[model samples]
Target: MEINLKNIFIAFLKISTILLGGGYVIIPIAQSELVEKRNWVTKEEILDYYSIAQCLGGIIAVNMAILIGCKLKGTKGALTSVLGMSLPPFLIIVLIANLIEKIVQIPNIDSFFWGVNLAVVILIYLAVKEVFLYALKDILSVFWFVLILVLACLKVNPVVLILSSLAFGLILARFKKEVKDE
Candidate 1:
């Protein structure tokens, strides 16, 4: 049951390479590998890491790599994991940059990318649903969701919406406590 640094790096490398979509697609794979398969962390802990990553100003995959690496192997682990996760994508993008314009110009290649884009959209939607399921378990969460949806549809800044939701949650929690005391 001992997890080593090399294994951790390989796990992240595999995820980074095989994940077809962008950062969000990492969620399910991470949940499965870290929480379910490897038992390196719990579901709640994974969600917490995800939330922290989202709040921070960087890519979720890199943030997650650091989080998981630190959790398993300390600072060195975090560094290696981040490097392992980032290097492949960086190199791939660089290698593809020259060919991308021509590649997209091809009808069959365009069609393939379009299909892949659609699949990525679906994957992102499923990931959002899974993440929300962890938090939206009560009436308050539903109310907050409705509020956020309304605000988002109206083109409000997401930062404002998030802050407003936090304030609303605090107020609701206080009200719930007061009602219980009465």
Candidate 2:
């Protein structure tokens, strides 16, 4: 089925509305809506796109939305999905910023935010578990995970790490191809 801009817009609206902890929390929701319900991409494909989104220089949620949109309908779909995903949060932040000074004085608002934080923690935990379960598919992947984790702990710049990982992967692929041809 052909994807319309309206469809992409609506999909992002649904995804963005329920999202509290940001892009990471969107995984389960995206899996259900985009993969299972809409069949825009498979579980594995979405995960791959999520990884790619993470390595790039933008908000993961926007990147994921664009990747999924592009997968579904190309350039127009990508722009439409980004527009859909961004507007709600932008508007929300604007509204929230306007109210922050007054709202911070209320005890109940603090409690509400604390509750939201707890919920976000849980959602993030589930998303991480799901990602690890799928991502650690082999010894090589495990090795890379450890290496990346260590790098992160050492305070390596994320952009540097991403570029290094890309270079490493390309070199490994090239070496493997050459070895196979030998």
Best by TM-score: 2
In lDDT terms, which candidate is top?
A: 2
Backbone clash count, each prediction separately: 0, 0
* Candidate 2 residue 54 C-alpha distance from true site, Å: 2.4
Collision count of model 1? 0
Q: Looking at model 2, which ten-residue stretch has the lowest summed lDDT?
A: 173-182
- Pull out the clashing pairs in model 2: none
Over the stretch 1-182, how does candidate 2's per-residue lDDT look in tens digits? 24688988998988988777556777888877787788878777877888799888879988999999898889999999998888888898888987888888987977887898788787767666766767776788789899999999999997888899889989998777642210
Question: What lDDT is reached at residue 39 by model 2?
Answer: 82
Q: Which stretches of candidate 2 lie over 4 Å from their true place?
A: 153-155, 178-182
Q: In terms of TM-score, how similar is model 2 to the real structure?
A: 0.82
CA lDDT of each candidate? 0.77, 0.82
What tens-digit string does per-residue lDDT give for candidate 1 at 1-182? 36788888888887788677566778877876777777887766777787677766777778988998998999989988888898788999999999987877877876787787788777766666766766777776678788789889999997787677667757888777642210
- Where is model 1 poorest over a 10-residue stretch in terms of lDDT? 173-182
Model 1: residue 20 alpha-carbon error in angstroms: 3.5
